[model samples]
Target: MDSANSKITVLYEAPQPEEYLQLRAQTGLSLKSLDGAKIGLANSIFAVILRQEDKLIGMGRIIGDGGCFYQVVDIAVDPAQQGQGLGKLIMNEITTYLDIHAPKGAYISLLADVPADQLYKQFGFDYTQPKSLGMYRLIAL
Candidate 1:
């Protein structure tokens, strides 16, 4: 039941809180909103959606500057709707965008939560080198 054949329409730069909520709920990610802000905090990003009919069933995004670095984040698909390759649909779009637009020699990275690493590998993503380390700083508001 791969969604690759389904009529899933993709979009870019979709800033909607409701859709972000649904994706967060499905992916079990920690997302909190202050005021009415959407999940967009990146100066440059590639966002894509998977819609069946008019409902958004899946989404993924890459965020970073245009020329120096990129991080693939927030790739989510409804849990009840897993195993349909909808995530693949979302990743394909994001990867295409990075391949076409990210500056040459820019370092692209992402933290794969678990088994999703396999999906990402299809899109030319990989783990960082042993000499390199990943770091993060939580936003405290």
Candidate 2:
């Protein structure tokens, strides 16, 4: 997509509480009220939401325990809007936020899904190694 046709808005302001439902549904990122509340409480949660007028076209977020470790999460753009680089726009915003806010020695990480790995690599993310690994437990709903 041409830059002229697409406009990306980066908002440092808090995520709208109500939008969580739509975000969760669209991104397939499991979000509960507790998770929402946790995001609300964090001192370092940065989010970027892309909108075409009133419709939300894309969004990305960074969440973590705060000072030492941070994780990129919920990076999604509508499938219809894919290939337009909206996901890259969202990542750029998140990268800026981390660059400005995260302190030295901070460990930033993300779990990429398939082709998205190529995108995240541009931002300096890498796979875990022999020293450690990415592990997660399924949360049965």
Predictions: Cα RMSD each: 2.9, 3.1
lDDT agreement of model 2 with the native: 0.74
Residue-level error in angstroms, candidate 1, position 124 = 1.6
Model 2 segments more than 4 A misplaced: 1-8, 13-18, 27-44
Model 1 CA lDDT for position 119 = 88
RMSD of 1: 2.9
95-137, model 2: which lDDT tens digit per residue?
9889998999999999888889999999888888788888999
RMSD of 2: 3.1
Clash pairs (backbone) in predicted model 1: none
Per residue, candidate 1 scores C-alpha lDDT tens digits across 50-84 of 76667777777777876898888778887867887
Judged by TM-score, which candidate is best? Answer: 1
